[model samples]
Target: MRVLVTGAQGQVGYELLQRVPDGFAVFGYGSQDLDISNADQVRAVFKAVKPELVINAAAYTAVDKAESDAERAYAVNSDGVGLLAAAAENLGIPLLHISTDYVFSGDGDKPYTPEDVTHPTGVYGLSKLAGEKQLSEQCSRHLVLRTSWVFGAHGNNFVKTMLRLGSDRDTLSIVADQHGGPTSAGSIAETLWALASVFRRDGRLGWGVYHYSGAPACSWYDFAKEIFTQAADLGLLEKSPNVNAITTAEYPTPAKRPMWSVLDCEKLVDAHGLVPKNWVQELQTVLRQLGERQSV
Candidate 1:
C-alpha cells in the first residue's frame, strides 16, 4: 500500500522515511515541500498522492517558542491536523497522527492513560490537544498515538543538544524535578510500521488514542548523565562532563512543561502486543548513527 508522510525532516518523520519497511510505498514532504498549515496545499497533496494511508508527522514543535507564536502553532498543530483528518476521511483512508504527553497537566501521581482528562499547561500542549479533538471529530478511522521526549540521530532534540553542550562545557545543569522517558525516534517509527502491518492484515485492528513512550522514566539530569556516559564509552567524547541536577525553578523557560511526562504503554501492549523499546539500549544505536554521520 502507498502511504504519505509529512514533516519528513523531523525526528519521528525522518525515522519513518529511513525505515519504511518492505512492500510499502512511502512518500514524504518537508515544510518547504508542503506547508501543512495551508489547507489548499494539504488538499492538493491528498488529491495528487491518493494514498491508502496517511501519517501526519508535520507539526510546529517549538514548545517554548509556541508561547510567542501561538498563532503559528495552532495553525499547524490544530488546523493542519483537521485538514489531514478530513482529507483522510474523505478519501476513505486511515490516518495515524502523532501527539504529545504534554496534553496532561503533568501532576498525575501515576502514568497517564489515553482516557485521562487533558489540561495542557502551555500553548504548545493546548494546541496539540485541539488537534486531537479535531481529528476525532472529523475522521471516522484514526489513530492518535501520543508520545513524549522524542530524540533521534538527525534532529535538534534534547540528546543532540546535550551532546553539544557536554562536549564544550566542563559542567552543565539539567532539571531533576522533571521526569519522563527519553524516547528514540527510531523505535517509534518501527512501532508505527508494525501497527500498520497489523492494520493491513486485519483491517479491523484497534483504533483511537493510545499512549506510547520509552520504557522507564528518568529525570532530565539522569538522561543527560547517561548521554555523557554513553558518548564517552563510544569515543564520541574524550571525557564526560559534570551534570549538575537542578530544580525547574532554577532554570525557567517560556513554556511550562509537565513535571512528570511519563505515559502508560499497557493499552498499546493490549492492542498490539508491542512494548516500547528500552531507551538506554536504543541510545547506543542513536549515538553510533550520529558518530558515523559525523565521521563521514
Candidate 2:
C-alpha cells in the first residue's frame, strides 16, 4: 500500500517520515511539495501518487497568529482539508486527517467525547472545526483524529521550549488554569501507522471522529513542572529551577485557550482497542534524543 502524507516537516509528519510502517510505501509531502488548498494541485498529486491512503498532517497551527491571519488559517485548515477530502473521495480511499482539542469550548468540567458539541473560542479551533466539517460532508471514508498538546523531538513544541528555558534559567512561569494531555507526536505516528497497516490488510476500518491524547490531564504549569522534573532526573537540566504557576489572567495572549480541553478516549478505545500512553516516558526518550544524559 502507498500512503501520501502532508506537512512532512511538521512534528507528526516528520515522525511518519522517519519511522514509516512496515509493508507499505510512503510519500511524505510538505507545503512546498503540495499546496493542499489548491484544488488543481491536490488533484494532480493524488492522480500521480495514486495512493491507497492519505494522511493530512498539514495545518496552519499558529494559534495566536490565526487570530490575525484568519484567512490563511482557514485556507489551510479548512479549505485545504476540503481539497484533500475531495481528492480522497475521488480516489475511493481512506483519508486520516489530524485535528485538535481546541475545537471544544474548554469550559467543560468533564472530558469531551467525540459526540460533544463544539464551540471553539479562537480562530485556530474554529478553523479546525471547519476542516472537520469538510471531511464529514465531502468524504465517505475518513478519520478525523483530534489530538492535544502535541510535542515531539523533531519540531518546535512546548517541551522543547521548556527544556531550552529551564536549561538556561532558574525559573519559568506557566499558566495553570488550562488543562489537557501533552501527547507526543511519536505516539500519534505510531498509532496512525498501525492503523494504516490494519486498514491495508483488511481494506477497510470503521472510520469517524476519534480522540487520542496522553494518559493524564494537566495544566501548562503542571506540564512544565513535569518537564523540568524529568529533565533534572535525567540529568538533562543544569539545575532544578522554580516553576511558578500562574492563572491565565496573568498570561495574556492573542488566542484564548480552552480551560479543560481534555478528551475522553472511551469511544476510541471501543473502536480501536488502543489505550493512551504516558507522556513522561516519551519525554525521557525525546530528551535523550536531544543529547540529554541519562541519570546513572
Candidate 3:
C-alpha cells in the first residue's frame, strides 16, 4: 500500500520512515516539503500522491512557546490536522493522527482514559484538543493516538536534554510533582504501523480516540535518574550526575504542565492487541543509538 506521512523529520515521523514494513510504499514530507495547514498544499499533495493511507505526524509542539504563539500552533496542530482529515475523507482513506496527554486538566490522581472529560490547561493542549476534534469530525475512518513524553534518537526530547545536561554538569534538578509515561518515538511508530497493517488486512479498525503510552508512569525526576543510570552503564557518560528532585513550583514555565499525565492504555490493548512497551528498555535502546552516534 502507498502511504503518505507528514512531518517526516520529526521523532516519530523519522521512525515511521525508517521502519516501514515489507510490501508498503511510504512517502514522507517534512514542513518544507508539504505545509499541511495550507489548503492548496494539502490538495496538491493528496492529488499527486493519491496515497491509500495518510499518517499525520506534523504538529506545532512548542508547548511553552504556544502560550505566546497560539495562532501558529493552531495553524499547524488544529488547522493542519483538519486539512489532512479532509483530504483523507475525500480519498475515502484512513488518517491516523498523534495527540497528547496535555488535553486533560492534569488535576486527577488516577490514570486518564480516552473517554475522560477533556479540559486543556494551556494553549498547546487546547490547540491539540482542537486538532483531535477536527480529525474526528472531518474523517470517517481515523485513529487518534494520544501519547505523552515522547523521546527518541531522532529529535529533541526530554531524554536527549537529560543526557546533554548529565554529561555537562555534576548535578541537575528535575520536577518531581508531574508524572506521565516516557513514550519512545520508535514505539509509537511501531504502534501506528501495527494499526496500519490491521487496516490493510481488515479494511477497518476500532477507530476513535485511544490512549497509548509507555508502561510504568514516572515523574520527571524519576525519568532523569533512569537516564543517568542507563547512560553511565552504556559508557555514554563518564559518570551519572547527581539528579536533584524539585517540585513543579520550583521551576515555572509560561505553559502550565499537567501534574498528572498518566494514561490508561487498556482500551488500546483490548481493541488492537497492542501493549505499551517498558520505557526503561526503550530508553536503553535510545541511549545505545545515541552512543553509536557519538562515536561516529
Model 1: per-residue lDDT, tens digit, 1-296? Answer: 89999999899999999998787898899999888888889888988888999888899999999999999999999999999999899999889999999999999878999999899999999999999999999998999999999999988899899888988999999999998878999888988888888877777558899988997899999898889999999999889998889999999999999998999999999988889889998899999998999899
Evaluate all candidate structures by whole-model CA lDDT and list the values in order. Answer: 0.91, 0.90, 0.95
The weakest ten consecutive residues by lDDT in model 2 span 287-296
User: Over 4 Å off in model 2, which ranges?
Assistant: 292-296
Tell me the tens digit of each residue's lDDT in model 2 across 231-287: 788778877789888999999999998999899988778877878889878877887
Give all TM-scores, in the order shown. 0.98, 0.96, 0.99
Candidate 1 C-alpha error for residue 197, in Å: 0.9
For each candidate, how many residue pairs have backbone atoms clashing (under 3 Å)?
Answer: 0, 0, 0
lDDT of 3 by residue, 1-296 (tens): 99999999999999999999986899999999899999999999999999999999999999999999999999999999999999999989999999999999999999999999999999999999999999999999999999999999999999999888888899898999999999999999999999999999998899999999998999999999999999999999999999889999999999999999999999999998899999999999999999999999
After the best TM-score superposition of candidate 3, give how far the Cα of residue 248 lies from its true spot, in angstroms: 0.5
The RMSD (Cα, Å) of candidate 2 is 2.0
CA shift of 61, model 2, Å: 0.3
Off by over 4 Å in 1: none
